[model samples]
Target: MIIEKCNICPHACGGTRYEDKTEGSLCALPALPKILKSHLSKNIEPGLIGSKGSGQIVFAGTVLNDSECSVFDSESDNKKSRINGKKLAQMFLTLQKQGAANINLINPTAFAHLIMEALREQPLQIPVVYSSHGFDSLETLKQLDGLIDIYVPFYKYHHTQIAQKFAEAPDYPAKAQIALLEMYRQVGGLASNYKKGIEQGLLIRHRVFPDFSRESIAALHWLSHYLPEGTGLSLLTGNPYLAWGEEAKNKQPLKREFERVKTALQDLQMNVGYIQDRETGEFFYLDEI
Candidate 1:
């Protein structure tokens, strides 16, 4: 299906994105993808990082207005560098040659059309990881059924008020729920190659907000109901760097809050990928927890 007006994301802003140099869209992107950076990184999920790290491609821009977004803090100008589908395919091939476990596409929802084109030009040998903000549309995800392998989506919020306040997307919670379900439907449950540290399945990452313990617990409960018994969950300690200029109310999570979230997750008895210590910033896995 041809996307004349960009409905790639859930926003459906209807901006004219067929032209190569078009602007005035929600993501401020052109038809071709603007590559921010591409590298093999060990900082990703422990399971995805084999002896050779996962090949990561950080795409420019976002559809959400997250107050605690780190992309803006790190990059001064995201629209400066650009690459077409063919070049992107070559980059994917290059990473595979260098022994990358999988090709991880960061913030790819905005450039989903171009990414699909790239894959068509050079079909990937390794698994394709779609690392997203969990605000994807079901139609777009259905189009990506056979292409994607691992779905690492960040389920940021379960409360509508919190989602609207921080992300300017009031319907985020509902959309995230449906999007995650579609992802699981496509990829099934978590399957791991422990010896190689390679995984092919759904790994949901949820960050515990400072004063949102209830919301965090609610999100966990929803996951427990819908997702498989041993779904991989990464409960991250919210990044202090992302909340730098935000309100004092939205600062780092408190010790008690962390304990509450940890206790709530423990009660669920799901597969906890990693949990960060509130004080020491240390990470513990399911067995350790």
Candidate 2:
């Protein structure tokens, strides 16, 4: 299953990735995995971080190449972080040994082929989670059917113009909708263990923008109507620093805005994950329904 012409992501840049040394892809990366870090973290979804913490593998590149992403801006030399699939498999084993609740793959869309190879080399004991940016191709996600146990993806935007304005991905909303539907079809609904947090299912996260509450509401409504009854939802307060360009510059949501969105989500009466306080780094979860 070597990728000769890379269609692993939505970009489908058609690079010769199997040739090892070639790097003509839009992500400017090879088929090899490039990891920034792999460690236990409690900063992720509350349901994912059990007693031992979620095993987070933050990959180096993104197909979207979002300018606001700190990882993309900070790393000057990505080649230094490159590792073979076998080594990535070893990292997974190490995390499992360290009592990680689940194997969380962050920003893995660009390296989907490489990750599949790694999983093949070393089958995971714990659930394999695909935490992505939501700009994914259905064909690529179909390849991960049996391999991925949980899908933690963002429903970033409901409006096509907003997606195109920020991420230069005009088709993001449509692609994300189809991809999420596929993810739900694969995993069904949320399943958890008392000791092991979330074991399997689709957990959708929507980051609330300062003046874009309508979009947020639209996303929530869509999830409520379309997804399964037990599907998990996380409403994250947007970070001003993570915003890019004049449209989002120095923008922060007012306290009242947060309250309004929170109240609307509570009204949904679904399984809410957590409402993060962007300023204080605190997490607030809704009482069990």
Candidate 3:
């Protein structure tokens, strides 16, 4: 949807489009033509694989807001959710028949629990990868842990940094990361550096921002060393030329960088996964059954 003045994200500035119903603000609304396309499917890197495609669901909004809260913008479609989490959960159950084993949720709000409850009605043995601005609590993770098979936390720009950029919420990043750390403890890994959870694991994402991968890489490094095991990761070396689509742009990195990260994972023998560095299989959208 083309939002005239979008405030759905950490960037609260209104640009003068029209009002968006999902965002409830003219700024966060979608422009025409941009609202018609809903054909979207993203490939998991070589690391975070499931036998079937990830079961994706787009809910209303987010719990975390940031300057880099570009998750919603990546989807070319206006994810005008079908109202509450109950319907959203039913939607996923339907997709399960079509080979959607995992999930990549967009704009999942605090009401995500409602969706989880839907799944819990008859729990999934499969994983549900959550894509959102970083920051989630252990309690929240525990609530979701029952319903989710895997946790994929997307770490956005730092809270302090997002505050500087959007000037809407300064503490978002900190709160989100704090939640992330708690999440790591619950399902990712423990603080003692020795504890490990029985659940699957987390696939931490670091999308290359603007013209750099420093912050993203640093996040990976820090996450990798923290647990006794390594953290599965996907480094989006490519950025969508468009300001918000950066995360979805799939670019191959230099052979050296690819090997370097690959080697580190090998060293740790971390239960790690990543997008393949090979250029041949760099397919982004395809219907696989």
Off by more than 4 A, model 2? 18-24, 68-70, 73-75, 192-196, 244-246, 249-251
Q: Which scores better on lDDT, 1 or 3?
A: 1
Q: How many clashes show up in model 2?
A: 0
Show the lowest summed lDDT stretch of 10 residues, model 3.
Answer: 31-40
* Structural similarity to truth (TM-score) of each candidate: 0.91, 0.90, 0.61
For model 2, name the residue pairs that clash.
none
- State the TM-score for model 2: 0.90
Off by over 4 Å in 3: 1-42, 46-52, 63-81, 137-139, 166-169, 189-199, 241-271, 275-289
Ranking of predictions according to TM-score: 1, 2, 3
Prediction 1 global C-alpha lDDT = 0.78
Taking the tens digit of each residue's C-alpha lDDT, what string does model 1 give over 1-289?
2246788888888876643455457766567666777899888667777778989988876788885554732323644556778888999999999899899998888888888888888987888999998989899999998899889998988988988888888999999999999998998767544324546778898888687788889999999888876567878876766552366234678889988988888888875466766666665675577
